[model samples]
Target: MSESFNQEQNPSEEKFTSSFPPKPIVEEKSQNALRRSLISLAIYALMFYFLFDRNIVYIAAILLVLIIHEMGHFLFMKLFNYSNVKIFIIPLLGAFTSGKKQQVSQWQLSLIILAGPLPGIIIGCLLFWLNKDLKNETIEMLYSSFLVINLLNCLPFFPLDGGRLIETLFFKENYIIRLVFGIISIIVLLFLFAYLNPILLIVPVIIGLELYNENKHQKIREYLKHEKINYHVDYVNLPDKDYWLIRDCLIFSFPKKYNLLTPGKYEYAIVEPIVIQQINAVLQVNLNPDLNLFKRVLMVLFYIGIFVGPILLFLLNR
Candidate 1:
């Protein structure tokens, strides 16, 4: 047990600005992100090649589609001035682009979520139209893969592009609603896994664990709210005192993960990084509710329209 907060040394005493830390650190982290991304993509390709389809064209087509889809999200995130943008390939579960913004604009997030699937869908439609005469198998797989994958992503389920859009527009921070939605989504995914690939069962399992963790930490968020601790700021902008205080809360909230560490004394342990990661997870992104009911409805209709466009094109081309 330590007495009053130490004025001796800040835990994040390293050189940092409000928005960014030191350049070398940023560069190292960026490199690590890229390395991890490439490794994941490689694993995805290998797994696809071995387990599911040995057809290199199909594998390449699928990989190309996923990368393009994720890049759309990545590009939009960058355009929105999000920090630390990264696209991660999750083997069987496809890829997702993650970035950090202290104050997230609801409109921007909705656009970013749509940005992933919309581009692929458009390209697929164009290819479908152009390849009317050219019976190319590679073109066939490319367009079909893009259409199927991107359209499925647009299905309104939690964590999927469309689901994320709905959640961003409607279910922000409403944990009980998200809990119900997430459970339904998991059930749907489990059915998908059963039908398509048993290995895909891992996707729902991972999502379930995340949903559980978030619900588990809800109490701590409430406590912080009661204590008037602000968590809307980015991790870099987090005050040293607040960080320690949150660490204390986290220890109590999650004793298993922090069992080796203590609350008060700032003795840097091996698990400090893990604790920081958890802290970041719990930190809320302030979503600006800029969209009115009409606008939100319009966005939903636009998403629906994208799906409709393909159906109409198929019917007309036939």
Candidate 2:
């Protein structure tokens, strides 16, 4: 009887073990992430050394300002519960903070964009106040650099904080508009380089290369549409009014082919269907508050202040 009981118990134990597998190795993933971060740091150090002409003091100062700007973005991303937040240094260009969000609203996007530059602007203002009495050249230079960096960051150009804000707020998924804007940005950069510093022609050249690459990708996507391919459709249960906003947000956050399904007039209930192909993934958009007139007015005023404030302060002090 004891032998029979042991035999039955062993099979049950084996079945239970088979049903529940072990958890994933968290440490391995963490170690891989650490390794990548170290590599990035090494690259940034090398680039900075060459870019700054080995001026440690200047490098330190620029790094401090860049870190502070990126920290603002990082903190806000964390606040919004975004995943995999990381700040990358782009040598001569600038530092950028990136994170993943399943669904983001227009207001949230605007706030995140503003977060990077707003803190720097505030610090610039404080530096201006401090330099008022002392008249220190170092303080003046720091203040000027801080203000210029942050203010220029707010410009509505692609990849810039200001450009991102405009894209989220107005352009949405309109590729044509974006392409036009990109061309305009390149032209403006060329003119600025010609007027300000001819040596800065490298910036426009880089922009042109990037634009060319983007256009090539766009053509590929267009060609894919004409080919016969297996596609998946996802129907999202959302109101008609919320369709475009959610569609824009999804496309902006996660780039993919998306088509909006229109319901018949006889259909009483609205179920927004999104047809997706090439990627097998389902996304649900969360409803978020819309931007109002009051907020719009405030944003405009804030932008005006940041742009003119530094120049005005310098003139007044001089």
Winner by TM-score? 1
Q: Which candidate is the best by lDDT?
A: 1
Q: Tens digit of lDDT per residue, candidate 2, span 147-255? A: 8788878877766788777766666556689888888887887886678657667777887876764554344333323322111222223333222322222343334
TM-score of each: 0.89, 0.64
**Residues 5-99, candidate 1, lDDT per residue (tens digit)?**
22332222332112332211112288888999999999999998988757888888899999999999999999999988998888867888989
Alpha-carbon RMSD of each model: 6.0, 15.9
Model 1 ranges off by over 4 Å: 1-28
Task: List where candidate 2 sits over 4 angstroms from the true fold.
Answer: 1-54, 193-206, 213-289
Give lDDT for model 2: 0.60
Clash count in backbone of candidate 1: 0
